[model samples]
Target: MIRDMAKGLNFPEEATAFLGECFDKITALEDGNDQLALAMDAFFASKDYASILNRLAEQTGIHRYSVDMVFLLLCADSLHDIYYIKELPEELFHNTMMDLKCKLLECKALHGIWGTFVTDWLQGYFHLKRYALGRLQYNTIEFPYEDYKGILKKGDRVLSCHIPSGAPLLIEDVLDSLKQAYAFYPDELRDGVLPITCHSWLLYAPHYEVFPEHSNLRKFYDLFTVIDNEATEGSNLDRIFNVTETDDYSTLAETTTLQKRFKKYLMDGNVMGEGFGILLFDGEKIL
Candidate 1:
């Protein structure tokens, strides 16, 4: 099952085999082990995932993140059952589950391992509160801004769109994802329009200074009506550069053009921050 899921998520053959080995070890360790059994139960019950994860690491002598991957694979059956009960499309489920492989790649890039630190974030998938629709991920969120309410009021149902890593945020793909969100959540639409909100560093206005006119990031930033910008202590350096730490910016790699530009931007005493924006999509297009 782990191998099948790994393949479904397009995991490399080496990663697939390693995950299978972890699964086998975990299965063998589960029988007649009361403590291990308790931890597994707690994991499935959504009780203290960190503690369960730590316990698994101690018991199995495996890296915490590798255990995390195995645990996610263990929960695959239940997640599938939830998707089935919700009657969501299989493609949607696959796209959402693809986040696992994405995060694994991120872990490999950052730490040279096949694991994830965002197991808590993955809970939304198991709970059915999030979906991946093409180039974006959407989670149901109440309109969080009260200070500048226009068409959307506080506590109103809104889809919070997130730009997941691993893809160029092309305009066409983003538009298609918005269209899918409009069709997927008929109940959440207001007057045939889907209200979407985003809060991410990509929307940070200052990034435009470094982004070229035709850069995809800049293009995506222009899609929303930004309402707020706030200073952040640290930037998304880890995400942007695939490095685990950002304390010493001098060590950051400049593999991509954006990376080179952003490194210079940071070195020149500029700060990275986040912005909040809203978009109203009227089924066919953004209104």
Candidate 2:
């Protein structure tokens, strides 16, 4: 049940166990282990990699503490999804994470402050928002785009709105887009494709959500999904051309076997309405 709470997230069984151990540490702290308690507390509170490292460094006498364990904790906390983690012994895992961290730091030193860290922040925000939806048990629509509707401009900012369907997103087009982002931010992709899972609509912005299944309240549900380090519960829809209540959203009115169910839902006038989609992009205009 715990494993299944996380669907889209992928990680090794040992790493999974390690994550559980982390929670257990939280529990056991009440029994004893002062250093462990303090260190873990700091880690849980850390918002960025630099802060995370600094917190651990501050506690020199942490009993039974290893840099690798902290590294593992940081990675797990930062990415939310541990699927990309290499299943290695504690020493090796720590070594790998440290290498990545040091590289990122070095990139910052050479490329100035905002190079790689900003990218991490963006991807983190993307996943965090998706996790929020998953927490509500919101099932996202992962549909395909075969025709030219419109393409989303790509960058690092949390999308404020869903992009409208204009040009059809072909398979090649999707791959090319992913490739470009990967090329632009190669270091972040070292673990694999940095995930970008958002709701059909931009939930990060202060908007309204119609939860007919649960309530009639129109409240903001656009919480960043990455905030939940455990990712034990959340929803995320990441695909080439994800559908939303966006621009010309009614253009999806053409009922077909591919997305008949989704189309019917959109047509139902329930959770999603038409033309509420907004695509987010930064940097390159061609993205």
Candidate 3:
């Protein structure tokens, strides 16, 4: 069953198993008394991710940030409880490569289905062709590392819609809806970032955006692919993208498409987020 799901992702089998192992180990908490101590250790160590990336670059002949992004994505996928492919803003996934590693230390499983969440709005707004090479804006949070877990919660929704909402939302309405949708997330959908909004109408709402902190990682690196590429011939691609629904079923239909496509992709392909990387080379290296 696992193999079937990993196929669509087109990832190496060894990598998938490695991630599964990491997920299992973290969740198998025999002791809960050391949560604070464990968190302390992780917090300090996280600051060195950049150094770790440099070391890996020296060892593997890859750029520092490129290797870091891959490491982050791998760590994120390894610890998540679900996976899905969708468009998302570049800002939200800013530290996604680093944030995923942080998430694993705490052992939280991410969740989301395949394609039941795609729309025209998601497509145009969250394209890799535009944001992959952009600079990511940074912010100071209350608990940078501890609160990192919440990043994926935002990521799941962003990827599903292909839109980045630039600013973070403390909207009470969306959080409420997320509570219900998440409870019903399936058993087979074992791992990656998952999002559930507090707004019921927004669950499959036609037009919504992911809070800036949790957009797709590819966007952060300014990466684009032939698959997500499009010709932007004088269109307002930069304006705040919104999806206006013709009827209630518009979002429901989009969500359904996301589900059907994700199932087939997982069953027949490799794991999501384990695709070809764009930052494989530094600016000086020859392709």
Candidate 4:
């Protein structure tokens, strides 16, 4: 089951077991103190994420923020709960599950999924975050929106046809939609370079004895194979860049496509903060 999921994330087959082992090892080390060790998890689980975050911030003297550690570990611990994809076809199920789990595990998962919910938004108005000298806007695009005969008003009426993503959404699909927006606003997207990011839930493998922060690590370093290399262009080619397996990313990270794809992340705001990076292509590449 895990192998299938790891495969979907384009993760290595071997590391799936190793990651499970890591979780088990963490669990074993926790021993009888699991509850105490996971106190932060309890706080966040009870919707006190903000309060705990504040408290942890004030305690600068403390090293090794156990609260934060527990939160992410809890995320890892719960990575396998995929009720949404359970009924999907076997071939389609694992990838879907991995995609969703990865999203849920991402550090900024909540804000990236929905806007930073706690921010003040009066009269149905809210400000979105941005990145890269305003070159990148964070999670500001609603998958379904106006100017393309979008509903214009939020209501029951559906337009643009909704589809259940039984797998991770494709970069090509994202680009297609982005182009639609580009068609509407040409001046803003001047020079054909529009950089939007896509991220997935992935617990990366070790890098120089360090894990790359264990979140969505896709810079789509391999996407050029599809976008630049015509032979690779197709329906799910974007997913070929999914770093699902642990060591899979580390190996794929070092490839002919490395320059074509970047083994990197934004200094900030590729999405909310961190742990949400997949494909954030530059304008020249797509347009």
Candidate 5:
């Protein structure tokens, strides 16, 4: 079942094999050690499962990433349960589950492992707090900006949009996702307005200096009414370069135009950071 789940999530063959091995080791360990068995149960049931799993990893001499993989696979076994309960579309389930694969790849790229530290974030999917409709992932969040206190107010319910790494964020695909979201969460809309919010490095205003006006990313940035921009040192480097270490810019590869431009921007002592924005979706278009 674990292996099937791995394949179904489109995990690479090497990653799938690693997950199978971890699952077998976990099964054997739990079967032989009653205390370990109890801890495994607690991991599944407890909200502080990451800490528990970290302790288990130390006790059993298994890599932390491997422990996380076993836990994720165990969670994957019941993926359909949430879908059934939420009455979410099957396509959304598949699209959302693909995030698992993306994060696994990210882990391998960043740490050379098939495990993830973002399990807490992944919990949103299993706990029914997040969903992927098309090109974007949407989750309910409190309006976090102070600029819109009168119009929207802090703590007011809003749809937080996230861009999952994969295909290009074509305008058509993004529009389709927004259209789907406006329809899917009718109860959340007020006066046919779906308040969507985003805070990401992609929204960093200085990208305008790096990205051409016609670039998909630029187009994405244009979709929002940016409210704030603040310097967050090194936030964009890892995502853009796929390398964890960011202190030394000379070692980074300049394989793409954006990378070359952004790398030069950094080498020139300029910092890149995230921006906060809101998109008012009026059921049909971004208003």
Candidate 6:
């Protein structure tokens, strides 16, 4: 019973419809004979990915703490479904899903200043806007504060917004600078690429900032190539570090697929690895 499934996982009554829908889809798989990997393939192959991600972000109200877990569970199900040939039983299947859900509630998705600031500010800004305004209205303006707002507003109005004591720092300022150029290019980024880029920047930016003595953003310089070809040397940090530098779609596709496959492999472990091996061996045999 999915009710048991939800109760076992401590999921709220609000998730009843959502979890029921997921369970219904999983149960619909060939009347209990379908394997886990196939079910996941079917799930991901369908519109579930966008739906679940959208729920993780908006409906579930768990973006801050539960999102990483949802992401992990998403790939986990996908990889396991792609690798495991065995059909999961109702109990185990429900249990695994519940465990994944519970695990998500415990996962730490944020890593850098973005993580810290988003937790304190972004969530607060969205959840408690009036409170944030009360705090930020009369303090010294921060870098990314002025920067990100401009991008979000699509205007270049310099803010005199003051930061209150113990206020969140302007992590979005750096993100804003990066946003200026990539305004709406990668639709995914505009949609739900927050974690990817936030994690990337969190890993890179601090070293470039406070401890310039100990870090080098240039370590990642070659990763991106300017598509314009006229990109100059040392024009600006953001432009210099643009990921869209290259004009090669193949390179971009390969890079993206490689990252996706690797992430799948990492999340799903030997399941994905063995699946790949079987695919390779089967292809060789057919050849």
- Compared with the true structure, all predictions reach lDDT values of 0.81, 0.32, 0.28, 0.30, 0.80, 0.29
Could you arrange the candidates by lDDT from highest to lowest? 1, 5, 2, 4, 6, 3
**TM-scores for candidates 1 onward, in order:** 0.93, 0.22, 0.22, 0.28, 0.92, 0.21
- Model 5 RMSD vs true structure: 2.2
Candidate 5 residue lDDT tens string, 1-287: 77888898888999889888876766676442453455446544654566667676776677887677767776766767667777867778888888888888888888888888688788888767898889999899888765473558877888899998857889899999999999889977877788888999888888777875689989999999888899988776768898866679988889988889888988999888899888888877888
Candidate 4 structure quality by residue, lDDT tens digits, 8-40: 555433444543343343344424134334443
Provide C-alpha RMSD values for all models, in order: 2.0, 19.6, 21.0, 15.7, 2.2, 22.5
* Residue lDDT tens for model 2, 114-159: 1132334323322323211101111123322322123322333222
Candidate 3 residue runs with Cα over 4 Å from true position: 1-45, 77-287
Model 6 clashing-pair count: 8
Candidate 3 lands at a TM-score of: 0.22
Once fitted onto the true fold, the runs of candidate 5 whose alpha carbons sit more than 4 angstroms away are: 31-46, 147-150
The digit string of per-residue lDDT tens for model 6 on 231-271 reads 12222222112232333322322233333442333234211
lDDT (C-alpha) at residue 190 in model 3: 19
lDDT of 3 at 9: 42
Candidate 3 local lDDT, 1-287, one digit each (tens): 22233333443455446544432333343432133234323323443234443444465454433333233333333323222344333233332222222222222211111111112211221222112112221111122112223343212322121212332323332233233223323321214323211111112111112212233322222332211222222222112112222122223222333334433433443223211111111222212
Clashing pairs in 4: 9-244, 11-244, 11-245, 12-245, 102-201, 193-283, 194-283, 198-278, 221-261
* Candidate 3 Cα deviation (angstroms), residue 247: 41
Q: Which stretches of candidate 4 lie over 4 Å from their true place?
A: 1-14, 30-92, 100-147, 153-287
Error of 1 at 49 (Å): 3.4
- Return the clash pairs for model 1, or none: none
